[model samples]
Target: NSLAQFVFGFTESGRFGAARQTKNSLVINMSWGVGLGMVLDDKIFRGHNGFAGEFSHISLFANGRLCACGKQGCLETEASGWALTRMVKEKILEGSSSILVEKMNGKGEIQMEDVIKAANNDDVLAIELIAKIGDNIGRGIALLINIFNPELVILGGSLAQTGEYIRLPIKSAINKYSLSLVNNDTQLKLSQLGKRAGIIGACLLVRKRLLSLS
Candidate 1:
């Protein structure tokens, strides 16, 4: 799904959108986990076992919280949609007030979308959570920027919909963590194709594959 998303950014913007003609870019899909897809020199990068772009599991903390991948302190522990939901639930359990408490009604579940909606509606707790997670995610991206120094970094998926609530923190963190000279070359933007990025990229991938076989 993530690799397909990179296809969307690589082709859509580079060919038709404002970032046209770009040949090197990266896509970070912020859903259940932080999914990454890289395009360098106009080609997708699949690592040795085709398991590349697992940006979420890049263990950031030595003694931090445990992640679903059974690792402690992974970036996903703080930055992904699952992380956002987890943080909200933890805060609520600790008596942190937010509209989410009312939305959950003390029994039902609170989802990622609910938090995003709350943030967009100016819920203080939700906004704070997003800012925190965005900062962590940006730290991870900063490492990538310093290394790959791609032309663009496209952020997509559910969490990114919070708009500047998320983007600003990520941008700030990137500035703080990455080298000015390196990050200066990168253009970070939310996916214009929005939620449909993965689906469209999948379609484009299939077409490309079939055409190659022909």
Candidate 2:
């Protein structure tokens, strides 16, 4: 679902105020897990078995956190919605205070949306954690930029809705980690298609396929 949306990012000219552009672009959808999609020369780049963008499981950390994929230190462990919830729990356990604690009201579950709400409301701890996640995400993106040198990288998924709260950190990390030449060629922007991106992408993909067959 996420990949479909990311693929549609290549067709976002109408929504994001630009003309249809970029045969080479990438999209990163950061939800409970991370998803990636790429358009190379106006075609979707699917690797062997059509599973090219399992980016969440990329081992980018040494934090000893186990991923659901049975791997340790995957990128998702540090830069995803699941990671946000985990970080919130750890912060509370360490006696850090936030509006999130009050919002939970002892329910003992901190959804990513709750944290975003707190951060938007000026909750320091929430913002701090989000920045950390963005930094980590940017690090991973730096690697991608180095390899793909894509013209654009679109940030999607629920986390992207955090706006500048997440964008600044990711941009900072990309600048810090990627080579200046390659980094300069890439632009990062939030998905303007919003939540509708995935469903819309799916429909577009189907239309394309059907047209191709005809």
Candidate 3:
């Protein structure tokens, strides 16, 4: 995996961040994309690459899965936006009976949100599909906890809207693989900020930067 094979290099050379300096960072490896961190001295730990706290990759694959980055076995292959959407498309095409199928006007042209809505309404196939994605998400998180060893993990983004269905599996996965010491200090929880998490998190960064200038 590129993440492991180049972890040290990325952490040092800003490979994971667009920033030119090694500032403290906040890495948020969401189910769909990768984010970097920039912290320093008990704060965000921005390595050379100004990317610290990123953990969307842990090689939890089954030895072979197609990734958009052209990687054969990355976490993105299993639980990312790419992965979830792929799964949804396949399930619908498989003739599965789901509200999603109905939403597509009896066709199989489903979108990500459609599946989420169908799942929320208790569609059998939708639930099964979501659970499958949740399982993969959990597996990815387990690898993340074992590697980054963070103290707290908050899951945010569109998928978070799925509610407990996503959290339960992720919690289960982390517990299954994290070392006792890591798990003891770490807590897995959903994002409480709702749709505002992204904007708020970004605003926090801006506020911190402005304060730093003061």
Candidate 4:
């Protein structure tokens, strides 16, 4: 709740303070772990206000789905960090007979790391769960492709460490949803920054502010 509130406040203030630069301004952002994207040329491309590049919360489905944003079938409901943890927790709870269960010692309190470990070992339950997760994630990205027509998409986060286990599904989704010409122009990539992207991006923000004061 605190983070969400902070993000909302920051966005509100930034929007409130922007100098309305109608030039060839650029905003390169790494967020949502759906990947990083850049905004160039005209248009904020973030929708109305700062919500354009908001990958954290979007309608993944139109049905009655519940989201942290208190919305139904939001993309974050099934694709965000919170969503990943929730799925891992639920799979462990299902007692679906996985090595994951053994790793938890029947306590059923597993995290994304546990899921990844179990998946590495090729645990039946872990494999299936990860695949399901990859599929859900792919579906989410597919939604973005349909909407944004972005030039590139980068995968990063603790979860993206899973490598092809995750990217494959996202690629599959892109294949299925986007047209060949558009999708081909769109390069789906893994983050070169590794796990440091968010931290680095934040630091870059502060550094820029300092430079501007000079």
Better of 1 and 4 by lDDT: 1
lDDT per residue as tens, model 1, 1-214: 5554554443443333323557777778887778877777877777777677789889986757888878899998888888889899999989999999986666888989999999999999999999999999999999999989888888878887899999999999999999999998688888777777766666676777789999
Candidate 2 clash pair list: none
**Which has the better TM-score: candidate 2, or candidate 3?**
2
Tens-digit per-residue lDDT, 41-155, candidate 3: 3354545654444445545677687666666777667776667767876776777666665656556556667767777888777677666767777666666666666555556
Cα TM-score of candidate 1: 0.90
User: Any idea what lDDT model 3 has?
Assistant: 0.57
Writing each residue's lDDT as its tens digit, candidate 4 over 1-214 gives: 3333233333222221231232222222222333323333533233444444555555766757676667788666666555665666676677667776565676666677776777777777766655666676667666666666666555656666667777787788778866776567666666555555555555554565689999
Residue 40 Cα positional deviation in candidate 3, in Å, after optimal superposition = 8.5
Model 4 has an lDDT value of: 0.55
TM-score of each: 0.90, 0.90, 0.74, 0.72
- Per-residue lDDT of model 2, residues 1-214, tens digit only: 4454454543432223221377677778777777887766756777776677778889999999999899999999999999999999888878898987765667767898888888888899999999999999999999999988888888887888788999999999999999999989688888887677766666676677789999
> Each model's number of backbone clashes?
0, 0, 11, 4
Q: How high is the lDDT of residue 146 in model 1?
A: 91
**Model 1: how far is 164 from its true place, Å?**
0.9
lDDT of each: 0.81, 0.80, 0.57, 0.55
How would you order the candidates by lDDT, starting with the best? 1, 2, 3, 4
